[model samples]
Target: MTFLHTIGAIFIFAPFLAFIMFVLLSRKKLKRRSIGFSADLTTFLLFISVPVSVESLWGLEISFAVAVTAILIAIFLLVIEWKKSKEIEVLKYIRKTWRLYFLLLSVSYILIWATGLALTVISFA
Candidate 1:
């Protein structure tokens, strides 16, 4: 239980975790930072962190929300691509979907922390 709480505390601030990991990984392996690789890696970390953070924040497991959000974002991106070109570009579609997820999840992660902090503050007051 204590171990899990420690991990929860770390992942609840996953942006910092992701950034540190990215920096160290890039420094160890590549001389120059690759924006594309960084984005993809950060997205993967955010995906993992979202559910963990949500559960830690409110004691609610929201892995379902994360899964549904991913599916919806993919569908939304596909629809936009299909409308513009009347066909799907597999590679482009995947990139767009992943980037969109990163965008939404990053925002959501911040909001979750902010709300958690607000709730704690209010409770103490």
Candidate 2:
């Protein structure tokens, strides 16, 4: 595999490993907050990985696929958040950690998309 491919693999898979760790470590606490955080993290990783995997296996353009998947996931999350906004308890925790959540999502997408863009550019070279 090339250097770009290796970086792409890491960008796609690292979150998955972190998710597993979150699950394992949170078993002791097992609170709703931890569970919710883990779920959101998992969702984010899944959203990022689907397109990256498709591009890797099928030789599709990464930038377009990643962008589409990211937008779709953002819309889906927004809808879910809107529907659940009435739940004060859930909203409280979500609001408290919203920054962290956004940061994670932003970083993951940026890394994946950057790697994808690099790979695409290399392919055309």
lDDT of each: 0.78, 0.62
- Top candidate when judged by TM-score against the true structure: 1
**Which candidate wins on lDDT?**
1
Q: How many clashing residue pairs appear in each of the predictions shown?
A: 0, 0
| For model 2, the run of ten residues with the poorest summed lDDT | 93-102
Candidate 2 structure quality by residue, lDDT tens digits, 50-73: 556556656766657556655666
Question: Per the 3 Å backbone cut-off, how many clashing residue pairs does candidate 1 have?
Answer: 0
Q: Estimate each model's TM-score.
A: 0.76, 0.41
Q: Which ranges of candidate 1 are over 4 A from the true structure?
A: 1-13, 23-33
Tens digit per residue, CA lDDT, model 1, 1-125: 99998875675456657566666778767656555566677887788787888888788998888998789878887888989998788998898788788788888888888898899999999
